[model samples]
Target: MWTTGKVIERIDWNEKLFSLRIKTDVEPFIAGQFIKLSQMRDDKRVARAYSLVNPPGCDYVEVLAVAVEDGQLSPDLKALNPGDSIEVTPKAAGFMTLDEVPKGALQGKHLWFFATGTAVGPFISMLATDEPWQRFEKVVLVYGVRLGEDLAYLDTIKQFIEQHPQQFVFIPIVTREDYPEGLSCRIPDGISSGLIEQKAGLGINAEHSQVMICGNPGMITDAQTALVEKGLVKNLRRAPGQITVEKYW
Candidate 1:
């Protein structure tokens, strides 16, 4: 059912990217789950699923989104200011949480998160919690965007690095322009070329890596193909494997 949500805060990352922190009655949810935001438009309901960026125990829900050109709802969302009301799902939903990863023997030592664009939101939510730090020896985040200006949440990421210097790695990839702190290739190309692993100083294989990829469909497909070539398999509930993915679009 739909619940009324008030926009309590907003953060403009760039002209196109922004974050909305909403106060609502949405039930507690897992870190990586998503909630649908909706509005009534000309007698029709326009809704979109956005992954919750805030960690699970928060009193509010936060989502990172980009205003897609000519999108049905995002442009309107972009125009919203604090105190504006929107409709939200009362309960968040999705199966991309860390709980899905296998435990004990199959649970690898390194947890890798691959994200592009606003898909990094869910990963950020997961990282804010203690589960990953307690469970894995190493955690890595590979975030890719179109340009340097498109990267978001740098300060939060920096905090993670400071808190876990030896155990965390962040690889930024900017494809269209120079990003001295990151790579110039697309995510799949980086993996295929070994540049990503070279930066992490750790190789991905079936035994030691648990990878969760969330991003544009094209990136997810190509990245998964590259990982599969490296012996990692798709993670499924029935048959646990190494790679897990959520396509943002």
Candidate 2:
């Protein structure tokens, strides 16, 4: 299941967030799926799952990761350089995709994407594909970050919003920013104050909306609980689905 790839580029978006583009021979995977990357030393292999940020059909795979100060994989990952080869697992896994949504539920309905840190990876993947363009009437992305500098993909997301003026809404929230523009207090605050509803114009009602959430455990849990309190349910493969969630941590 593991393959090798050379690091093609390392993008420093901020002091805490970085992205790596790896050149690999593996085939593309769905937008919301993740790949496990490994490195071998001595007799042991260390690996971690990272959501692919590149859209399907790209020649290279890109992964965005936030570096926790003393985290195991991140500090080393952030130090990678071009031409350095890293082990990558071929198989991609996760259920947080459009395919998991009920057959007709997403069609002509508003799709709300909630994310924090690297969780924006999959949503960016979904936005690049024709899936969101053709299936949903509207797409609202609420990305929460600790500081304004942590909003790494805002430029890309803004460009997408500009290009698809009628299709998508991009909202970036900074929890620790003092005077952030185009930023709100937090995801939960946005939801409770009806700011998210006002921006999406779909309200928080379950009938016309389907939400996909990804992020740290606490953020994901809190967001999911808030959505459920507003009447959303977890999507399951067996019964066929509502909200899809993937926890980065």
Candidate 3:
């Protein structure tokens, strides 16, 4: 289930975030799915799940990760270089895939994606694909970070926004370091407080909307509770609902 791939590129997304582009011949994966990557440590296989940042079927699998200072995997991941061998699990994982969430237009609903930190990985893949734009009347992506420096994929998201203009919305939320552009607040606060909807001009209604959340445990829990209070429920394979979650951290 695990295969070795060379790190084709190592990106310094920011001081806090770094990424790896692994060239592999694995099966195609869904946009919001994740893969386990590992390296040998103390004679044991140490792995961590990382959401794929690129669209499915790309020649390279891209993973966006926030370097956890003094953490188990961060040291090794950050130390990777081009041509460095990394153990990549071939089987893609995670329920964050779009197939598990609610559809739009046909179902008369909107789709919202909330992400923070490196959690932006999966959302970027989803937004790049044609399925979302075709299925949703409107799609809003709320990306939250601690400071303006943490803002990422601006060009990529901007290009997608330009192409879809009317149907896709991109909002960045920064909780620290006063930024004149992006709204400043926690993602759940932005939603429960209505500031995010106000900026997008499209209300997030539990009745006619489905939300996908990916981030740290705290953010995911808070956002889920807020959405549930608004009449949304977590989608299950046996019992479908209006919300889906995948903890990226």
Candidate 4:
């Protein structure tokens, strides 16, 4: 079912990237899930799934999105201003949350998040919760984008660092341009080349690392392959393993 949501706030990170905070009633959701936004055109419904950026229990829901060229619904979403009304899913859905990660002895010492473009939204939601901090010894977020300007939620990330300076690590990756603080290669390459682990000052293995990957499918595929080479396996409900993934597009 759909619910009417009013845009309460909007943040434009760049020409193509933006965030919408909407006021609406949605079923309680866990972090790392997504909700669908919709619009009707010529009696046809146009809808897309957007990962929630805000954590659970918030009065309003937030979503980070990019205006894809010639996209069916994203452009319309990009044009929305505060007070604009939109359609939202009453229930959020997805299985990429930390809940899917193994618990007890299987839970690794370090939690790594690999995201690209707007896919970083879900990871941000997960980080906002207390589960990651309380469950692992180290939490690292590796965010990749075309340019430094595309890196959204830096302020919130900074706050996380301030609060857990010793436990949190943020790594930025800018592929198309120069970013002094980030790597200039794709995520898979970084992993295969050992640059990612080197920068984290921690190696990834089956025993010590649990990786959650989101964003571009290309990155997900290749990054998963690299992790597998390092002895990590795909996480499943019946047979839990180290790596969990969700493809954004």
Candidate 5:
């Protein structure tokens, strides 16, 4: 289940965020899946899982990666150029896809996707799929970053919202920058102060909402606790679902 892909393009979406387009020979995959890339250095094998950002039916595979200071894979990946070959594992794995969601719960419900940093990966995948767009009456994405520059994929999300204005909502929250348009605070602060509800026009209650949380472990824990306090339960495969979470650290 391994293949080699050539780097076709590198786009600096922001100062710290970049998108890589790799030409692969494999068929398409579910939007929420990920690929494992291998880089050999010093005769040691190092690999990392990166969620795909390209739409489900695209001809090339696109992945958005953040440069972690002194990170093993990020530094090398950041330097990749077109015509370079990288090892790509074919079988993508993760439980964050729509198939893992409870069948009837997601249909005709409001979906609130909250993410921080690179954890926005899976949500990007889901948003590109027909299942989410066709099922949910409202799709609200709340992405929290350190600053305005860290808000990668803002334009992409805006494009999605622009394409389907009746169905999608994108709310960007910046903790470090004083941006005039986005929520000017942390995600938890927004939740506690009813800023989230006020902006999205939806309460935190589980009756009309389903939430997917992806971020650092601390942020996920705090967000889950805050949501639970508001009476939302964690969704599981064996049980009816309400919230799905993916931890970054």
Candidate 6:
């Protein structure tokens, strides 16, 4: 299940975060799924899993990555240039997919999407498809990062707003930087303090909507607990609940 792809495009957002678009005849994958990519480091082959940034139906596959200080994989991954070839796993897999979201949840209510940092990848993937906008009457996507500059996918949000026009809302939260346009607190605070619900004008409830959370383990854990206090249960295969979550590290 290995394929070779060329780096068709590359973007350096900042010193820490970067973006890559790979050109390959990759198989179609569900939004919210991830691909395994391998690169050579210290003469040893190392593989890591990265959530695909492109939505379904796209010809090219995109990925967002954060560089580590002298990370074994980062040096090679970051050095990718146009026409550079890399190894990619043929199959993509993950459970944070929207397909797992119960049909009953999106029939006519709002769907809450929460993520921090690069965890936003899966949500972007989900939004690229027609299922969310077609089914849910309204959608709320909340993305959290440390600084305003760290926020990615402004173009994606712009495209969504232009296409849907108020059908969906994106809230960017920065804990350290306070831009008047973005919230300056953690996402859980936004939920508990009633800011997220108030801004969206829809209070989250088990009967009316469902929640999906993705981010670092700390954020996911804290958000899950907070949402539970608000009457949302963590969704499971056997015992379905109101919230579905994926941890980014």
lDDT of each: 0.95, 0.81, 0.85, 0.96, 0.81, 0.85
**TM-score comparison, 2 vs 5, better candidate:** 5
| Model 2 per-residue lDDT at 103 | 66
- Greater TM-score among 3 and 5 belongs to 3
lDDT tens digits, residue span 1-249, model 5: 678999999988676688888988756678777888878899998898888877687767888888778898987888899999988887667787777666674433788899998778778878877888877789999999887887777777888888889989888888876877889877877877889889988787778788888888888888888888888888887676578887766
Candidate that beats the other on TM-score, 1 or 6, i.e. the better one = 1
The weakest ten consecutive residues by lDDT in model 5 span 99-108
Could you tell me every candidate's TM-score relative to the true structure?
0.99, 0.93, 0.95, 0.99, 0.94, 0.95
lDDT of each residue in 106-153, candidate 6, tens digit only: 333778899998889888888989989987878888989998888888
**What TM-score does model 5 achieve against the real structure?**
0.94
Candidate 3 lDDT (Cα, whole model)?
0.85
In model 1, what are the clashing residue pairs, if there are any?
Answer: none
For residues 15-102, could you state the per-residue lDDT of candidate 2 as single tens digits?
7689999998766578888888777647688788999888888878889987778776777788889998888887688878888877
What is the lDDT for 179 in model 1? 89
Taking all chains together, the TM-score of candidate 6 against the true structure is 0.95
How much lDDT does candidate 4 score? Answer: 0.96
Q: lDDT tens digits, residues 1-249, model 1?
A: 999999999999999999999999989899999999999999999999999999998989999999989999999999999999999999999988999998899998999999999999999999999999999999999999999989999999999999999999999999999989999999999999999999999999899999999999999999999999999999998999999999898
lDDT of 6: 0.85
Question: What is the lDDT ranking, best to worst?
Answer: 4, 1, 3, 6, 5, 2
What are the clashing pairs of model 2? none
**Which candidate, 4 or 6, has the higher lDDT?**
4
Q: 3 or 5, which is superior by lDDT?
A: 3
Query: Where does candidate 2 have its weakest 10-residue lDDT segment?
Result: 177-186
Q: Which of the two, 1 or 5, has more lDDT? A: 1
TM-score computed on alpha carbons, candidate 4: 0.99
